[model samples]
Target: MTDKERLLQYCLRQGDTHIIFGYRLGEWCSKAHILEEDIALTNIALDHMGLGNAWLERAASVDSEKRSPDDLAYRRNEREYYNLLLAEQPNGNYANTIARQFLFDVYSVLYYSELLNSADDTLAGIAGKGLKEVRYHYKHSAQWVVRLGDGTVESHKKIQEAIDDMWRFTEELFEMDETDDIIAKSGVGVDVSGLKEAWKTQVSEVLEKATLSLPDHNLSRTGSKTGVHTEHLGHILAEMQYLPRAYPDAQW
Candidate 1:
């Protein structure tokens, strides 16, 4: 495929990923363990959704597609989604959710940092706007990770379990493919592989400060990059797409 085509596909895939994951995260709004956390989760969810809208609009413009952002987000099938498996993993417990968010926020901050220097002006602009939101998300999640990991015995245990359970899915975040190759070469994106070392350093340092051990288990899961996802995505998509799918062209 041509460079432009590859770039467009990458953008669309990334946008779809954010929308689906954001919709999933929104489910935690009033369901969090505490009021402050609940509001925080929802606010971050809005940020994700907002970024998704920008990316999707750009993707549609690039492809000259007629579908609206809502359509692209809600109408797509599960197999068409490109989000990492970690995002779709069921929010098992408070600690589990925080662990997932912590890791994702780390990667996202790094990803957007590189994107700010993108050769494509639109992508750079979006990244610039997104960096501020992501910075807060990372800080919030990092603080929680530390608290949960270093808190009471029960909290520590739960957070460690979360870290262990979620660790495997992190491999996908740094897994680069042909789409990454095109974008990196074109200066429109960062190489996922290049981000891996820095991500590892940051994550490991946080775990240490939190008094959490690095997961000894070495088995890592992948595949979401190519649209392969876990079973959880089906349910997430069903809930997220219900309004638009059922109502068809209805808008607020």
Candidate 2:
């Protein structure tokens, strides 16, 4: 593929993760245990949605197919999506959601730190803004991880369990393929593999503060980067794309 196509694909992959994770976070809008958290999560979800759109718009600019941002986001099939499987998993409980957020936030911090200096001006600009928002997101979510994990015996057990359940998906975030290879070589994309060690250190510090133990299991399930995902993604698309699919070109 050409460099243009590679960049577009890379941007789309980033957008996909943001959009799907934003949607999952939105699921907790009214369901959070407290009103303060309810509003906080909703706002964070919106931030993610906005960030995702920015990347998608950039993707549209480079797309030879000339697909619009909305078209790329709402009209894509499961086989075409490149989001991490972790983003698509159901928000089982507050603790489960926090576990997912903490894991991704840690990775996002390290990912964007390098991305801020990317050779591609547009991607670098997006990373510049994204870094600020994700830093707040990481701090917000990390505190909760500590609270729930170190609070009570019951809370501790539940949060630890959530960590274990989500552990298998974490490795997928750092798996690099050809798309990443090209971008990294050109200094326009991050080498995800390099982020692994730092990500682990950051996560370990937070987990220690939370009094949570890392899962003994090292087995990680992947494939979302290759358009392979868990069953949950289909349901997400079904609900998320309903209006766009049912009313093509229709707008209120």
Candidate 3:
């Protein structure tokens, strides 16, 4: 494929990833155990949505015939989405949710940091703006991870279980495919493979600080990057696309 095509596809994937994850996280706006955390999670979720909008707008510019950002995000089938599986996983307990966020935030910051220097001007600019937000997200989520990991015996146990349960999904965050290869060679997309070591180091440091143990299990389930997601994504998309699908052309 051509460079333009590669760039647009990369942007679409990034947009889909963020939009779906943001919509999921937004469900916790007023449901968090602590009011402060509720507001904080929603604020971060808004950041994700904002980033997704920016990337989707850029993607739409490249392929106007496909659909607008609204349609791309709200109208796509479950198998068409390119988001990682971890993002679609249910927000089981607070600890599990936090663990998921922490892991994603780490990868996002690193991904955007490198994307800031992309050859594609729009992609680079978007990454430049997103890097700041992701950095803060990492900090906020990391703090929570530490808090829960080291809090009390019960809290510690719960958070540790969350870490173990979610750890397997982390592998997909750094798995690269043919699309990634093309975009990375063109200097438009961050190389997920290269970011693995850095992500692991950062995660290890944070877990150490949290007094949490690393999972001895190394086996990881994969495939979401290629659109083979778990059963969870269907439900997530069902709820997320409900209004848009039911209303058809309705506008806000």
Give candidates' CA RMSD values in order.
1.3, 0.8, 1.3
- lDDT (Cα, 0-100) at 221 in candidate 2: 96
User: lDDT of candidate 2 vs native?
Assistant: 0.93
C-alpha displacement of 83 in model 1, angstroms?
Answer: 1.2
Q: lDDT of each prediction vs. the true structure?
A: 0.85, 0.93, 0.87
Tens digit of per-residue lDDT, candidate 2, span 1-252: 899989998998999999999999999988899999999899899989998999999999999989999999999999899889999999998999999999999999899999999998988999999999999999999999999988999999999999999999999989999988999999999999999999998888999999998889997899986799999999999999999999998886
Q: In candidate 2, how many Å is residue 233 off?
A: 0.3
Question: What's the TM-score of every candidate structure?
Answer: 0.96, 0.98, 0.96
lDDT of 1 by residue, 1-252 (tens): 776567667877668767766776788877888898889989988998899899988776766456666667778888877777888888888888889889989999999999999998999999998899989999999999999888999999999999999999998888888888878887888887889889989999999999999899988988886778888999888887788888986879
The sequence of per-residue lDDT tens digits that candidate 3 reaches over residues 143-169 is: 989999889999899889998999999
Worst 10 residues of 1 by lDDT: 62-71
Q: 2 or 3: which has the higher TM-score?
A: 2
Better of 1 and 2 by lDDT: 2
Where does candidate 3 stray beyond 4 Å?
none
TM-score, candidate number 3: 0.96
lDDT of the structure predicted as candidate 3: 0.87
